[model samples]
Target: MLPLVHNELYVEFNDEKQGPFYPAEGPIPFGKFRKHKKSSVELKADRIGELAKTISLPRSALSGINGSDQALLAQANIVQMEKPKSMPFDDSPFLQSTTFKNKLDAKTAIADYLGKPLSRLTDLQIVAINMILDETLDKKTVMDKIRAYFTLSSAGHSGGD
Candidate 1:
């Protein structure tokens, strides 16, 4: 519900999936807005696809509750509203793994094939090398893919090997 304008109560409508829309321009009175779907909360996976209910308590609703209970309820509501934070990117797992060694070997091989230092390789060249290396880092496989990429890049075609 929005603030009263000239003693008339106003309310806003918002659809979770489509977001809020202004019908007849801005907030309408509760009676003026048509109700659909009856307003239900749906629990879904992290990805979008269902309606999520927002837990909000108006000041009047919380006024009657005892301080301790109100604090607990507020904490619980906050927990429900917050999304879990993800761990930042880290390479510790591959620091000394065989996959790490293979990646290094692949990078070196690509640099050698292109007759350039690894740091001197362009972003596109590095990405092309990594794309092939991701499939299989065998020397022959890497060489063949790099050759294909080189051919395409030289032929005025790009982005695909």
Candidate 2:
């Protein structure tokens, strides 16, 4: 039977109706559900993809690895990419010592378009705003870029434009 309020399809199992099932999906594990987690190899593959984006790895080197776990580990070791030192809640020492606030304040047009005082913006927001604030870009362009940035960020995309 079609759900009236929620358009989810229900499965009829053993003369009983099971709901909230979608096409192309398996039966819900219900109480037996263990949260799906990526295995270590999958995690390492993800890390390799991320690191490859940041650093210029030779095609030959990547191909030579042939998806071996040891090779992937060796490549990761070669890059030496350390994770960021702190969480979002913790203040960044670099931002703390830098003059981004003063720079943002000095630009009245950019500040006005943002619709917030420098003090009101978070460090990440300030960084995004600063990154796109080229003298060539108008206030609307700047704001649009910043909007797109936050949208991508909220959608879980990371790294530069």
Candidate 3:
């Protein structure tokens, strides 16, 4: 039996030299492929710009383009063609730092303090706790609200406790 091959094509409008992605199958039609490629590149560039802004990184770090939409689109296409590998969280020194570990421990501590099963906590609750531990929220105020929501009477009254 012939193995099923997935036809994946990637293209970039900005840097035509970087790619004509054909991961599994043969080359894609240049005309239709270019249109989709350009749109994808634009979207990726916009996303990278937004992320850079959030992290306070220089825009150039995320996008090498200036004010020109054409240039931005081109750079994005080059990036897509490069098919950069995603950095694993475990490999990031920031994520592995003592401070980060302490914060993670604090989050786990909060879950333990509430006596609520970790599985029972909603995604929002987990995010809230992490945010609080990171000082993204005022600890005193956020803890009070969390305690009230969980109906936790005291620090030691965890369900398991």
Candidate 4:
């Protein structure tokens, strides 16, 4: 049986307000949800295609967060072409150092994105790393262009020569 769903959508145009006798969307204004708790966005299947158009803050904008937040923010698949990863709490020295609070996770993610072991990075990959370290490349762009072939082919293309 189809469950009865509420229709509380309300809208106001330039001249007047529009609403059902009982609004389906809002009796109250939407406010910042409690932090660190999972929240589900309810949408009809047909409307979900619009969800892809939504976005959060950019990677550089995420840089000012605290250590744990910075690490968590690092592993997010902000790169449109990449898949999100399930990374553990990496406590490696490379990350423990002030430079890379999330470097270990980033390294693991880059390795997985390239389908190669971290130990086998090519010279081009090294160049990409240098570029990333020097802020010449955005990590998101690097991952987005991971297998883009012609774009960074001179630097490297995924794994192997």
Candidate 5:
């Protein structure tokens, strides 16, 4: 489960009511936004998927409730009218963890493996590292793929290395 903030955006669509309605992006509506910051209010992925199935609204409308471009991206693949299968939500523990030491260790390990300064890496880089690690790729192969993916320069490194 994850806490979500529903900040309405000002946009007009023929299917929706006129004036300050929620949009996926752009300006905040009515100079205020709705927030669900409490852990109890958070919705699990499966629960969200189920709730989405019951709604007549399109996926785009649900994305608008998320109130961020990243949230929109996360929901892009979900079918608005279909129910999603139950799956473990990885983010729950990560978000609720009392200590960040494990997270920091993982990040540092990724930076070390990439042979680059951690400051230069983006959030996407961290995600890629986690993906590769979870898939249990061999060290050299994973590093090579990551280097090529990021176009990082190295000795004997070809453009697609």
Candidate 6:
């Protein structure tokens, strides 16, 4: 979701397994966006996919809770509903990770695989580019080849776990 905002103009529908899309180009990697500072929370590896569920028990679900417990629950509700403050863009791993290179090498390779030129891509066609890159980086595999097989296969198909 971090990279999604930067390339929003061109790749509004990135499929994550690939990268953003340009209407003229198709799925490509994180290209050189005019503005490119992306911000995201860095959760520990141990907490990667853990969903924030069952963190607090509902008043109805707990029969023995007293008035103080109910007050605490109300306070918790307020905190949970408040919009979360975002961290600084420089805090993102993309700035330091080897997988998050800013150069167009990966983007060019992805464009070649998709049979499209980078500049020709419009503000549409690409979908979920960040997700694709994130998943690819996690797997330690080749980015272009991975994108090639998926783009050559079918529309709406994803290689993500």
> Lowest summed-lDDT stretch of 10 residues in model 2?
97-106
Off by over 4 Å in 1: 1-101, 157-161
- Report lDDT per candidate: 0.65, 0.64, 0.61, 0.58, 0.61, 0.53
lDDT per residue, candidate 2, 1-161, as tens digits? 95555547788978998887656656566687757889999999999999988988766686554446557788778653566798566657555532333444435655565566666766887776667764434545555676687677758856443
lDDT of 2 at 139: 42
Residue 64 in candidate 6 has what lDDT? 62
lDDT at residue 50 of model 1 (Cα atoms): 37
Question: Scored by Cα lDDT, where does model 4 land?
Answer: 0.58
- For residues 1-161, could you state the per-residue lDDT of candidate 1 as single tens digits? 86655443345557335424345456566778665533344323422343234455767565665667758888888533456798998888766443325788778767777887867666887787778888886766667778888877779865543
Count clashing residue pairs per candidate: 0, 0, 2, 6, 0, 14
Error of 5 at 121 (Å): 1.6
Our model 5 lands, by Cα RMSD against the true structure, at 27.3
Error of 4 at 112 (Å): 0.6
Best by TM-score: 1
lDDT for model 6, please: 0.53
Rank list by lDDT? 1, 2, 3, 5, 4, 6
- Measured on C-alpha atoms, candidate 2 has an lDDT of 0.64
- Give Cα distance to truth, residue 32, candidate 4, Å: 75
